[model samples]
Target: MESSLATSQMSDEIVCFCGQSSVTRTSLTANNPGQRFRSCSFYGQPDAWDYFSWVDPPPHPRYKAIINKLLRKDNSKRNDEQQLRRLVKCYQIALEVFLLGVIIQKIWL
Candidate 1:
């Protein structure tokens, strides 16, 4: 409930990139779109959301700790992506080496 209120306070009504203030229900039907919800129809696009940079805006001190934790979590995600890529490359290399070894053994034996 608190998060919902935050989102509501953060979001505002504005014309969409298409110059339409409201989109039809058919536009958002697949991604939680329905007659009850209003959307800009460009909700799926990253650029569809308005950007608001906090320029020296003050926040609760507790949020500072939360921000640090979130940054750590973001760094961990990068490490995880890197590890996953390495695993995939290692698997491919191992498979290729195994095939080459099999070919050599068959030819010699």
Candidate 2:
């Protein structure tokens, strides 16, 4: 779980087709959570699209379900947070409008 370890865990054996050295990445996908892979240094670029090699064996089935469930729960929490942010913004605008109306009424009186 150390991000520092992830980048430093290099495979001298793997060099991409583009001649860049491979870097290790942990998969976050539902099907293969926590599994490591070797990817091109030029990943996300046009030429490296096809470069991927597994560095670790496939995860056990039980662990896969647990990780996927955790990921889903985290995603749901983030969605709820975003919805709350929008609601708070709407309330702030409504309060500002109410204050503005009060000021206008006072001036007319």
Task: Tell me, by TM-score, which candidate is best.
Answer: 2
**What TM-score goes with each of the models?**
0.43, 0.72
Instruction: Give me the runs in candidate 2 sitting further than 4 Å from their true place.
Output: 1-21, 42-49
User: Tens digit of lDDT per residue, candidate 2, span 1-109?
Assistant: 1111122336436665555667789999988998999777766666454567788999999999999999999999999999999999999999999999999999999
* Candidate with maximal lDDT: 2
lDDT for each candidate structure: 0.53, 0.78
- Assess candidate 1 and give its TM-score to the true structure: 0.43
Clashes of 1: 0
What is candidate 1's local distance difference test score? Answer: 0.53
lDDT, candidate 2, at 106? 100
Please give, for residues 6-81, the per-residue lDDT of candidate 1 as tens digits: 1223356444445445343432222222224345555446656432222233444575556656666878999999
lDDT of 1 at 56: 35
lDDT score at residue 47, model 2, on the 0-100 scale:
45
